[model samples]
Target: MIETYLPNVDWTKMWDATVETLYMTAVSTIFTFVIGLALGILLFLTAPGHIWANKLVNLLTGSIVNIFRSIPFIILIILLIPFTKFLIGTIRGPEAAMPALIIGAAPFYGRMVLIALSEIDKGVLEAARSMGAKTSTIIFKVLLPESMPALISGITVTAIALVGYTAMAGIIGAGGLGTLAFLDGFQRNREDVTLVSTVLILVVVFILQFAGDFAVKRLDKR
Candidate 1:
């Protein structure tokens, strides 16, 4: 039945592509979360009145995040070709696709992190400070704990965006479902292949969203 409906679909190749896409998304999300979290923390702490407040630092960091975040993902991939090549030794394959994925996503996620952190009650932070809590203590015990729900929610959105980016990267030979869809499906005029790939991508997105929502619900105190 499966073969009859999708005659052109190669199950083996499709599975490989799905694995590659998952690998790229998983690895990139981990790096994006860490780097974005750090960037968000820096932006939050450096902004006017925070413990590490420094107008210059905040401005510079914010500028960098905004600039990178504003660039379209495809353009960002092209722009980062040189850097990706330098870092990964090739601008093709799942590994090569990672730098662009992480770079494009981290800043975006960073903004989300900042938003999440900002939503935390300022009074809690002030109370921590009044009680002689160290900066690190406030960040770990107060800020992160308070903002975890939002932070998880933000990363869920970023991870879904990365799924799309992987497809775009596939246009340039970054192997994944996108590459499979473009090269094997579209280029070869196989609508069945394209349809299958689209279904799989949707499946991945749905799983990520469900997992994220579950985490947020568990973490949310209110």
Candidate 2:
């Protein structure tokens, strides 16, 4: 019955492609979150009046973030090819896609992180400092807690973007649903395959959004 309407759809290959897409998204999200969070914190803390404020450092960090965040993802992938090959040993599979995915997503996520952290109340940070809280304590206890909701929201948006990035990466032979859709579906004139792959990508994105919203709701005290 299922195959009646979509006979060209290869369930086995679709499953494998779905797994590859999920693998790429999951691994990249973890790295993007950590690296983005750190970058955000650094940007926040080093801004004009913050604890680690330094004109040169803040300028340099912010400039780098803006530069990478400004690049188109597909272009970024192409630009990173040499580095990706050097780091991943090949640029044609799920694992090889990681370097480009993370590098492209991280700076964008970092900017999001900076936005989330900036929304934090300065008085709270000042209070923690006045109480003699260590920098680490202030970061872990004050800044992070106060901005938890925003941070979750930001990452949620970034994760969704990463899904799109994975699709773009697929066009370049990165081995995911994008690859399946473009190579197996589009090139082979298999519309059903493309449709099925697109549907699966949407499913993954919806799940990420739902989970992120649920987490934000739980973490948000106000």
Candidate 3:
């Protein structure tokens, strides 16, 4: 009777895999935003005419962000193998995948942040400077607050991208729905497992979009 309903998926294993996938996605997303936000602010401040502007710093930092963002995630996983092992004592689990995801997604998200920040009006910034606002004051009070809507949207997009990255991370033995679907389902020809995993991933994407858009609406004063 139970077999008739759950044919291939062991409920316990499926739940555990779901938890692992969410864990990887949550941890990586938080760190990626933290890193990306800082880097984005730095990039904006260093661009020509901004308070902290420095030609060499902006050039070097922008180049580094571009270099990392340009690499494909699969290649990034392989490249970060040694670093992952060093940080987490092994590179074949969800935890190990965290560093790789953070490194790869952070800069990609950072670029998004830079674009959002750049869209703010120069007049507002000039007004702030004329008012004798400190650099930190302008960033925290003027820039971040004004740009929250765009930042939230950028974060939503980046989070969606990270979901796909987590699946690819499963290729390196990172345990998640992706690992279950790819290794167990594909290898054993278990269509039920594959289908269930795909559906769950889709559901996750939908939830992220809904939650992100909801937040954006609440914060969007205009």
Question: Which candidate's TM-score is highest?
Answer: 1
Clash pairs detected, candidate 3: none
lDDT of 2: 0.90
Model 2 lDDT tens row, 1-222? 988999899899999999999999999999999999999899988999889999898999999898988888889899999998898889899987888888888888888888888888888888888999999999999888888898888888888988898898999999989999999999999999999999999999999999999999999888
Q: Give candidate 1 regions above 4 Å deviation.
A: none
**TM-score (C-alpha) between model 1 and the true structure:** 0.98
Candidate 2 regions with alpha-carbon error over 4 angstroms:
none
lDDT of 1 at 74: 93
C-alpha local distance difference test of each model? 0.95, 0.90, 0.91
lDDT of 1 by residue, 1-222 (tens): 988999999999999999999999999999999999999999999999889999999999999999999999899899999999899899989999899999999999999999999999999999999999999999899999999999999999999999999999999999999999999999999999999999999999999999999999999879
Question: Could you say which candidate leads in lDDT?
Answer: 1
Segments of candidate 3 deviating more than 4 angstroms: none
